[model samples]
Target: MRVMKLNEVINITGLSRSSIYAYMAKGVFPKPIQLGPRAVAWVEEEIQGWLQVRLDERS
Candidate 1:
């Protein structure tokens, strides 16, 4: 259950900042697991699997 920060997610997903947040809001993506007062992270395995799913769909 590895976790990643927002910046790491951004670099990996290649999605814009707003788009990332929007996708989370729309439930199209996983919500962040709150860390401290101003920090958050997402499950790395979940995001990795999500990317794999999208790639599979495109193929």
Candidate 2:
């Protein structure tokens, strides 16, 4: 169970920081877990699952 930082998520998903937040706001992306007063990270498995869904949609 690994947690990924914002930059890692951006690289893996090829989404800009604003786009990731926008998708979250639209309820179409996984939310991040608050790690501290100003830190957050996403579960690696959730991100991978989201990616799988996108791939499946293309099939």
Candidate 3:
């Protein structure tokens, strides 16, 4: 499974931190996996697919 941190996700998704968190809260985004006491990351493939879906929807 591919995984990435918040910063990388933000850069790739072009979504603001607040918007990313908001999407998660609304159950529209991938839930992050905790990698440490305070570190978390999303599954890379899932996020990528999510982005693809967003693009497809837009088109």
Candidate 4:
């Protein structure tokens, strides 16, 4: 399992930071794991799964 930071998430998903947070707010995206008071990261597998779902939907 791998943890990914916001910038990496942006690169992988091609989404801007605001869009990611907005999706999270709408309960449509994976929430990040809080690593520290000022640090957070998402599960890489979860993000990959999310991407797979999107790709599947496109088919």
lDDT of 3 by residue, 1-59 (tens): 78899999999999999999999999999999999999999999999999999999998
Query: Over the stretch 1-59, how does candidate 2's per-residue lDDT look in tens digits?
Result: 89999999999999999999999999999999999999999999999999999999999
Between which residue pairs do clashes occur in model 1?
A: none
lDDT of 4: 0.99
Tens digits of per-residue lDDT for model 1, 1-59: 88999899999999988999899889889888989999899999889988999999999
Deviation in Å, model 4, residue 11 alpha carbon: 0.2
Tally clashing residue pairs in candidate 3: 1
List ranges where model 1 is wrong by over 4 Å.
none
Q: Is candidate 1 or candidate 2 better by lDDT?
A: 2
lDDT of each: 0.92, 0.99, 0.95, 0.99
* Of 1 and 3, the candidate ranking higher by TM-score: 3
The total of clashing pairs for model 2 equals 0
Best by lDDT: 4
If scored against the real structure, what TM-score would every candidate get? 0.90, 0.98, 0.92, 0.99
Better of 3 and 4 by TM-score: 4
TM-score of 3: 0.92
